[model samples]
Target: MSAPANYPIESVENAARVLLMLRDRRDLRVADVAVELGIARSSAHRMLTTLQSQGLLQQKPTRVYAAGPQLVQIGVAVIGATDLRAVARPTLERLRRHLGETVHLIILDGSTIVFLDGVEGTFAIRAAERTGDRAPAHPSAAGKVLLASLTREQLRERYPSSRLRGGTTAAKKSRRMLEDELEIVRSQGHAVNLGESEIGLHALAVPVRDSAGNARAAISVSGPSVRLTEDKLTEHVPVLLQAADQLGASLS
Candidate 1:
């Protein structure tokens, strides 16, 4: 027998309802599902058992059903897709408007930093838009901020060689030096690049953290060194931090 195309399957609808209810609360009980879906307790129990078998829900010792591993994995993937660039674009644009400097959303990829999106500054002599560009992770402010989130073991894995290679003389020359710089970045909760990527180019970055307080990405503002002096960069930290928090909250 063929099912009607326009009609919703009762079992699927009930299962979706249970999932939605779980979203609003920490867990769900069969009795609660029964009442919410206007179904019998036995029917609710069967539905929950099926969902649990499918790994969408787990039955706890307390007799409650909570999100299972598969559901959690799906939620994490959705957050990743939502956080990448589109979700951060508005924050990037607002930061550029406020600071009048080029703003970039970036992520660390192995030993490289990939620019996911960027907004050009209003000034004529400003950092160029770096969307789709990749650079060594040890030099750029955003790269440093993201790297600071990793453990020492992870850092060593990414940079096995003691000597760090970069485009310019200002870049960190040794892995030990880079590690020390990352420690400072972790302590200060931000990062700075003063002509490390290129002479006379300055940048500042703050991390956009996830629900676990780990950096999922970084937001950076870049401009000429003369305009973004050390003092000016320090002054801009508050604004960048606020924007980073906003982006992080959106993902959460």
Candidate 2:
């Protein structure tokens, strides 16, 4: 006997796949998606049209379909306050208490670094710019760690082709100059924000890995930039790493 018909789960799943492909590829024509998914050209057209009507996708002047601006807004809304906030809150507080400095939990969701959680340190002078404020992913310590985890192709796909926007010199980000930073983070096992994201701020970030060894987020300590130098980093970096390891171990 055949099972009863239900929601078009297969179609819905395919739609999700198509949405992700559009997100990664950006500016894809119908044929490009059809070839990628191995679906008939007609089926691809229908899917694209359906998604476009729902504001999940858009067809541009070049007739290329991409993730709609509305889709990005929806994604930002859902992803802004994620479950990581709940999972990492106490960890962040404990980490701040141990270091006596501010701790921030940052996650790389798409091209943005989402501030998921944080514990403020009681240093009369501390790194308390804002909570839940997002910065573009390049100069931020958390962004560098996340970039180190991606393959070259994946990196290119996520960022615009021409520009690299790491930030400013005090923050060290410009469009198209991030390769060196990623290399350093990969080799050093962590990333540093040397007043790069902000003039007087210093941050060191360690990767927070899940059971799959994928960096789900980063744990970082941000303090006065004046005191955070290469030599001092030697002492403080380990504390950040240990905190990350404990978080990772709990995930296991």
Among the numbered candidates, top TM-score falls to 1
Give me the displacement of residue 1 in model 1, in angstroms: 52
* Every candidate's lDDT: 0.87, 0.75
RMSD (Cα, Å) of model 1: 16.9
Could you give candidate 1's per-residue lDDT for residues 135-242 as a string of tens digits?
A: 889999999999999999999999999999975899999999999999999999999999999999999999999777989899999999999999999999999999
Model number with the top lDDT:
1
Q: Estimate each model's TM-score.
A: 0.68, 0.65
* Model 2 regions lying over 4 Å from their true place: 1-77, 171-176
* Candidate 1's TM-score: 0.68
Candidate 2: 10-residue stretch with minimal lDDT: 166-175
Model 1: per-residue Cα lDDT at residue 207: 96
Candidate 2 lDDT over residue span 174-247, tens digit each: 43458767887899999887777777777888899877898878988888867766567668878788778878
